[model samples]
Target: MSATEEAMNRRIVLARRPEGEPGVEDFRLEAGPVPEPGPGEMLCRTLYLSVDPYMRGRMNAGPSYAPSVGLGDVMVGGSVSRVLASRLEGYVPGDLVAGFNGWQDYALSDGTRIRRVDPELAPPPAFLGALGMTGLTAYVGLFDIADPQPGETVAVAAAAGAVGSMVVQLATLRGCRVVAIAGSPAKCGYLREVLGADVALDYHDPNFPETLEAACPQGIDVYFENVGGAVFEAVLPLLNIGARVPVCGQIAHYNDSGNPLPGPDSLPRLMMWVLGRRLRMQGFIVGDHLDRLPDFVREMGGWLREGRIRHYEDIVDGLENAPAAFIDMLRGGNLGKRLIRVVPEDAAGA
Candidate 1:
């Protein structure tokens, strides 16, 4: 289709800056003409759009690792899409690729920042989950940063979610004993039964900290932190000397406005522990470790192919449901990697 003919595309835009927690009114759905691919560009139809906790930081008005979405602009996101038309030499129609396509039915890209996918090796949605950023986050954080050794105890919060789930499986594959902390009993069961965690505890329990302490009697050697706030507070005392902490996300504090939680500032105590114990605590964005992506893809893909690493996806249908799905994800409603099926590319036969 010609660029002018494709101008009737639909998209979700940022309606307003969210305060505390985001509501449905914060997004505006609009219909516009399909944008034509310019010279050296390609037209893409989104198949799967990712909904992640990190996007919460982009909705607020502040300086972040990435730019915040401006009012009336299409909300930014990563998506797996099929190239509808290509002006770029390396790309062609029917090629599935992953890129920053935002939240929409279709997007135009200049062939930069897009990676082609091999569907025969894995399904398309795997490009958004296991073989994509989520897998990279877990692999890089655990192997490169945390560096858990064989027979060591590793603890992960939000252990049944995307990054956390991958960490549990990978750590287990590495011969490390894994203890997982999930939000509910069901999620904990998935961690133990499906992902092979050595032990799983529900964070909702009144004595969750005590349970976690009991689970890690040797102290946590590697802590893959996905949920911060209370979980971090609970894990602080349980960290062994020379332990490694890979700070990935802080979903627990994502919806908090500016109000501090009821507690004394624990920075001093944390610093003391860091100094006294010679612990390594580091925060990282997955993009910073892009050089390791090739290694991660090769290893993770092999594991998945061998039935060693299993992944789950909680997919919602349509572009319009993105906002609600995102809100629900922040509330721990999603069991695994939360995604929205923007188009039924994978359901071609159905």
Candidate 2:
């Protein structure tokens, strides 16, 4: 972290807007002088970088809930970092924190939107996963939006993923029968054997629709939607009256080329079912619910301590590999929360 030890900063910047699915060519890695912390700012060396599904939306050039990453700018993301120098109050050199550091080896923060990470609560990398925004996203989406009742059958798409995994566990803890859906048998096994889901279904099965229907004989009372193409098509008809759906992400459609949907138009039928079922569907961005972070941290922290909640991370090493790892993650290649390890946990000044 010393200026004598490191002279340049390495970062990945958006090279171009992706046409459909992003490629490594869309990003460019560059080196520049490491930034200095000015008044009230802290110099942080990146430890871990989170790669998430929502980032796909940010790579586009269209309207979205958040601002798109402009060409030539650092790709937007959250990171776990170690403060190397501090002019900011309450923080000092060698303090680990979680904040927005983008895809870089180092960054400067004015202490805005940064939180102290207690290594005693969990590992530093965990701040980018279970005990961080990923966990908070699941907490807000399930307890605040979906609000599954005891005994209600809750169907979760991508149930083995970072957010979906959290949803499955939280819903199960709420006393709901969880029908966890994943693309692979191994993931489904994790959902069933490890996460305690009532039922687990693999979406790749040819009879997936029928299997899903059979899994929820009473009909799905709550659907935590993460993947939205055929998965939504199958879940729509099975939704019971007054069902609640918290739309978290549509990873299935994130790579669409803006072409028309391949199957027969189902909009009319979807609308009819929506009216007849009185279903409530809400799409939420977790950043808007930051007020709930303290409650989430406290409750989820207890669950982690009691072994009631488990978190898994698929970590890729090096800042240079972030682009490739991100591309692969979009293709359902990651099992849990995917992260890029920028620095070793036991490194000097860490």
Q: Model 1, residue 292: displacement in angstroms? A: 1.0
Q: What's the C-alpha lDDT at position 46 in model 2?
A: 91
TM-score of each: 0.96, 0.96
Q: Write candidate 2's Cα lDDT for 1-350 as tens digits.
A: 56625667899999998888899999999999888889999999998999999888888887778999999999999999999888999899989999998999889999999999999988887888899898998999999998889999999998888899999999999999999999899999989999999999999999999999998999999999989999999999999999999988999988887753544567777878889999999989899999999999999889988999988999999999999999998887888799999878777364
For model 1, the local distance difference test gives: 0.88
Residues 1-350, candidate 1, lDDT per residue (tens digit)? 45437356789999998889999999999998887788899888888999999988889887778899898999888899988888888888888899989999888998777888888768888888899899999999999998889999999989988888999999999999999999998999899988899999998899989998988889999999888878888998898999999998889888888743444666677789999888999999999998998888889889989999998989999899999999999999998799999869954211
Candidate 1 lDDT for residue 291:
93
lDDT of 2: 0.90
How much is the lDDT of residue 343 in candidate 1?
A: 68
RMSD for all candidates, in order, please: 2.2, 1.8
* TM-score of model number 1: 0.96
* lDDT of model 1, residue 250: 89
Cα-based lDDT at residue 118, candidate 2: 92
Measured by TM-score, the strongest candidate is: 2
